[model samples]
Target: MAAIWIAQETVDAAQGGDRQALESVLAGAQDQVHALARRILVDVEDAREATQEILILVLTKLSTFRGESAFSTWVYQIAVRYLVNAKKLRARDPGLTFEMFAADLENGLVADPPKAPDQDLLLNELRTSCTMAMLLCLTLDLRLAYVLGDIFELDHSEAATILEVTPAAFRKRLSRARSAVHAFTAQNCGLVNQSAPCSCPRRLPAAMASGRITLNDYPNSGEGADSFQAVKRRIGSVVDALKSYELFSAVPDHRCPDDIRHQLTEILSPNI
Candidate 1:
């Protein structure tokens, strides 16, 4: 949900073929674009590729910006369009229903397992992965609505503009998405319902056993990421329907790879 505002003058300079200005524009847009791509697309690699493609689209279409909206909104419009239509990107597994996920949660909970040296990091990874997979259970449109309206906390009008829908329509879609997620999590997630069968610690063992989580590559791991205690405290402060969403929002934004800017620089150098 972090955003860097691109000044209109900077946008104009970029449009006028200023390479540094262009890089600045794209760099400002990168984190947000990647964040949207990461949530919309399931795979990490797929999100990266899609983020690059969306930025290229933004670049190619730069001249068309007539300044009718904020540059960030314009960027989001392009990103939402590309992501919604990028069918070739990996689709969620056909069998990954709430029922299946519930069963998975129930199957491998270590009530009192020995702790690892990096328990917090591993638990963060598991929580992020599990919640992301939960989003995939919703259909693409619903998922977009939930992520934009709920997790990112974008205004309904703004989110509607990005999705090219009316505010009321967006709200309806978001309501559906929220209901589905809320229902599932209320019954299953320990953060939402303390008596629930699954907690991050309980599921860590299963996640590792299934190779869903590995120490060798911790995509969601980061320094000072929200700890389980912090997440629980936040959850306790929110209403029942919103606790699951609070948990989702608590996951750290996946950092965009540094090399993306370097790659963009290389791609734009010839034109410069």
Candidate 2:
């Protein structure tokens, strides 16, 4: 029921304050909520905190859900409202300009290849680090639009409903977002162009040193430098077929971390 839980009956039950149904709904929806928040928010820590708050907010507001939209769609609306506040509280963190990114390219950033094939941990780190940095580069509305349209692949009408915007407005926002990201990545990211000078591995040291990453804070997922290259590849190459957004999608999803997920589960479990 949680996985494909669009049945109006279950939604009605949950809305009616049925504890079990509410628990089931939240549990099933966790991954999606976590993923969206993580992408929109600044870091895992912020994302995790905001995710827990999002769940609680949804729990309290679920009763207000009018059922005019799909339950999942309604959930995203709540998620957006909660995250909007969270983003404002974040310290001013506009990322490098495209000119600076291009400078990194001209300066010839290089990726250090992972030693082994099973270094899934480093691959995870690389993907997370790069994607999070990229997301932080975007303005709030654009970031939200990009996540819903490009990463999550929400259609304009459905995404607009969740955003409370008309399809035309949503498309315009997404278009602006796509243009900004495409401009940067087409020249910078290896996922979009293998020949690009920067690679996740090469940037990893700087990120960790600068405290942009702190695997030490979380449960050891074996993402440390010597843990083998989780996504082991020796060289980058060009890919002509895929668009930049599709290339951006190649980065894996590192949703809200485990500790936060469990904390939420514990709080919501009794309700269930």
Candidate 3:
């Protein structure tokens, strides 16, 4: 599972000022890097900026990346370092906690999606945004640990190296983060527990009323990302019954966002 790292020769060539090689390396990793940043940062805009920063850093520090670890792990260290310093993490959602909503779910409330065709589309955006937003609720270090250990399925050793901690320490921290997510999601998220009160259809109006999403911006008949099928593909289909890493896997990569892809292309195009 851990074998999917950049080749040593590729790393060496890039570090040796092989422009095409550097571009190749950056291109290969940019989407995953962007996805990680999106989860680590508070919002999409911040994630986009952080991703661009990571792109530049990857190129600038290519020579410094010793091949002592997985190239992806090395890249994460740089991404997290930049996010820690550059990202002004948004304030935690005052009303956001799986525990708080858990009780409501336990009370046996069933809020189904409205009969409208766009209801499915809205729910997709809402749940995906909600999941990603939950990651931001954590402190920087814990957040990074959760993303690596649970979402990305990295081994304890690899994650520890990325965060520069002992394996034991990484395991302990990851346990805490994982437990928190599990407890909340298991109780409050419909996808995790069938008895949960919150369903995408149920939460759609509230999410839209607050301007978290727009119908015009997302339509069932739209094209590209706008088409209902397209939207579902980008934000994986909801199972309403996720287990373990299944929930995180359902969340799409951040670079899947077109704007971020455009930004990455603009930044890496000239240099790479």
Candidate 4:
């Protein structure tokens, strides 16, 4: 009976019509799918939709999953296809432009913080900065390579697999992406408010303003709360400084905020 049960599972998967098996496969790769989709869609609701489409494509195409590359690669390829199509579909509006993208990025960079702290303003800024269409249009290989490479700290080789390219090719793509981002920043520097930066009193986190959290009291407080708070204040100070920095003047690389700091550091590190 045990032998028969094992055979049944294998046969069901081979048939490729087993929805449960397909769902199981997708469930196992859920994080990977969401990450890729988020890189493409950016917006949470739209990313969710794109992810569903990618999963459906994977299920429909599972029969073609001959033991070629790993199943994850196959799924990523499918995801790339769906994401490209979705982008093309959205592009038909005819109103999209670099200006629109810059506006989106600048505005998104400081929008509403998540209702919760673990998913708060900083994380929102990080996501918006990474997903801004200005950055996405930087290449044809999808936006995964750039985001994963710098923002998420994924290695070049790992990024290459997600991008479906060799590490060397991935490096070239990253270079081009960085160049495009620089051009975008140069072109939009005039628009960033230099007079009042986003460090508005309202947006400043409590820890940054008062410095009273030194003695975080809780039954099971994490070991480094004080250190983390210090970093938060430092980041807050940077944001506050942007309000007064002349956007039109040459932006010193050292002054760039965390969102695009890596790119700025690469270009300005030598000058500094």
Best by lDDT: 1
Mark the regions of model 4 whose C-alpha exceeds 4 Å error after superposition: 1-20, 87-137, 140-142, 151-158, 161-166, 179-272
Ten-residue segment with the worst summed lDDT in candidate 1? 87-96
Best by TM-score: 1
lDDT of 3 by residue, 189-244 (tens): 65666566775566666667667777756321122234333433433444433353
Q: Which regions in candidate 3 have their CA more than 4 angstroms from the true location?
A: 1-4, 87-113, 216-244, 256-272
- lDDT-based ranking, best first? 1, 3, 2, 4
Better of 1 and 4 by TM-score: 1
Instruction: Report the alpha-carbon TM-score of model 2 versus the true structure.
Output: 0.76
User: RMSD, each candidate, Å?
Assistant: 1.9, 4.9, 5.4, 15.8
lDDT of 1 at 101: 83
Across 45-125, the per-residue lDDT of candidate 2 in tens digits comes to 667777788888777777787878778888888889887766554554456556765574344233564343333454455
> Which digits, one per residue and each the tens of the lDDT, describe model 1 over residues 30-131?
988888888877688888999999988888889899999878889999998888777677453343678888888899799987787588778877877888
The C-alpha TM-scores of every prediction are 0.93, 0.76, 0.76, 0.50
lDDT of 2 at 262: 57
lDDT of 2 at 88: 50
